[model samples]
Each structure stands twice: as structure tokens, then as C-alpha cells.
Target: MFEQAYGRLVCFADGQREIIAMQWKQGATCAVHDHGATASGRVHLVVGALVEERFSFDGQRLCHTTTLHHVAPCTIEVPPGLIHRMTASPDATLTLSIHHYEPCIASMRIYDPEGRRTVIVPDDCGAWIPEDAAAIVAIEPWSAP
Candidate 1:
């Protein structure tokens, strides 16, 4: 039941900061993919200590345990060109606050478990926008296409 809200983080180009209430259901998981330019150099935290997994796919199964980053409110500085994926364990149940420095475009992609993939557009996902974005449009997830 972790919900999103506005935070203290400030976005220079996009304005203020906003939080997204993502309910990583008991068994629900986010697709594996490196962050976009927005999160390229951002540092994030594992506020709720939820269980998850990180993995790599270079024609082989390379998975890693989701390390417990006890820094509840720590920042994560993600470098560019980092390929990774994650999945929520059955115990995950918290809100995710992703602080970005600018507007997200279509550079993000989802690594599908079914072997199908597609580009993830910010307007479509509505996860990278501000708290009060206008004229928004949702892009279809690669799950279908």
C-alpha cells in the first residue's frame, strides 16, 4: 500500500520533485532494463527494505540477489550504460520514489520475460512526469507489442 507523493528533491529542468506510488504486489515484478538518461546519474534508496532481484541477460541467465540497502533514504547514483533488471519478491510492498533531473523520452526499454521487448515512452508510462503534467499520453507496454 505504498503510495507516491511530492518530495523535497528538486528537478532543475523539470521543476519540482514528485513521487510515484508503485504497489509492487506480493509477486509482481518490474521488467529488467537500465535506467534512461534521467536516472543515469541519480542516487536512490530502498526505503522499505522490500525484497527484489537484479539480473543480467547477455545470452545467459545471470541473476543477482537484491542486496538490502539499509539506507532507507539513501540516494542511488546510477551511471549510464548499466544494463540490469529487477523483480519484486513475494514480500515487496512499498512505494518507489524516483527522482529525475529532466523529462524522460523513449530511450528506456523493457526486458520481457516472454522474449518480447519494446521501447518505453515516458508519456505512455506516466511514471517520469511531474505531479502536474498536462496533455499526457500513455504508451503501450511491450507486453503486448
Candidate 2:
């Protein structure tokens, strides 16, 4: 259980989208995990720096890893079920980022080093703010009415 804090930035009910800001101190790391079946995500760095790694698994073994280093003002797109992990750089002051989820993340799976899987219900984290009716929309305007 790595230490970190989450703050809800915004959300839309009918549209099924949300933005959550996460704060991480030096040495912090997010557990390797996947977004829910219907969800995709994008993370935008707001402060300091961190690393993101995408992994592929064969049976129970991890393989084909890809990594990205993100500093403030950068963004990365993540597809649903894409096993990934994030870590704050050791020299970082503090890492802050806003995570965007589509079709809203209901549940996700966390993976242990041995490839063991644990279902994590997002609601259980207790890090959400009440949904606002007048928040800025997350979808692209080209698709809007």
C-alpha cells in the first residue's frame, strides 16, 4: 500500500467522465494496475516529475515493458486494461497530476509483482467530491451538440 493522496477535480454524471488530482511525495509509487473494462484514461503532469511504465504479461509473467518520463505540463494517454505503474522521481520535490477517466472508473484491478490480481473498487477509496452540475465538460466540442 503506497502512500498518496487524491482530490476530485471534476466529474460529469450523464457523460461519464471525471478528473482526479493526485499528489505524491518523493519515493511514492502507484501500484501496478488497470482501469475498468469500459474506461480509458489520460494523466497530465502539473508539478515535479514522475515515470510511467506500461507492461505486457504472458500467462503470469510480465514482459515487453515500455516507459515514459513525465515532467510538469506533459500528458499521457492510457487505454483500459493496459497494465501500468507510476512512480515519483527520487529527486522530485512533489509530484502532482490530474487523471482523466472516460466512462468513469467504477472498478480496476491491481497487480502484484508475482502477477497476482486484486479487484479494487474505486468507490472504496473514498476520495471523491460530490458531482457538480455546472462543471466544464470533458468531451471534445466536435462531438457536442
Candidate number with greatest lDDT: 2
Residues 60-139, model 2: lDDT tens digits: 55554888888888898888778887878889777778878887776565554432434353432422211341321221
List, residue by residue over 1-145, the lDDT tens digit for candidate 1: 1112222333333432233333334444344555554544453545443333455545434345354432346565445645454333444456344545323323554444443433343433422222332422322233231
Poorly placed runs, candidate 2 (over 4 Å) = 1-15, 124-145
TM-score of 2: 0.72
lDDT of each: 0.40, 0.62
Q: Candidate 1, after superposition: displacement of residue 10 in Å?
A: 12
User: Candidate 1, clashing residue pairs?
Assistant: 4-21, 32-85, 42-76, 43-75, 43-76, 43-77, 44-75, 44-76, 124-138, 124-139
Residue 108 of model 2 has an lDDT of 63
Clashes of each: 10, 0
- Clash count, predicted structure 1: 10
User: Which whole-number lDDT from 0 to 100 does residue 136 have in model 2?
Assistant: 16
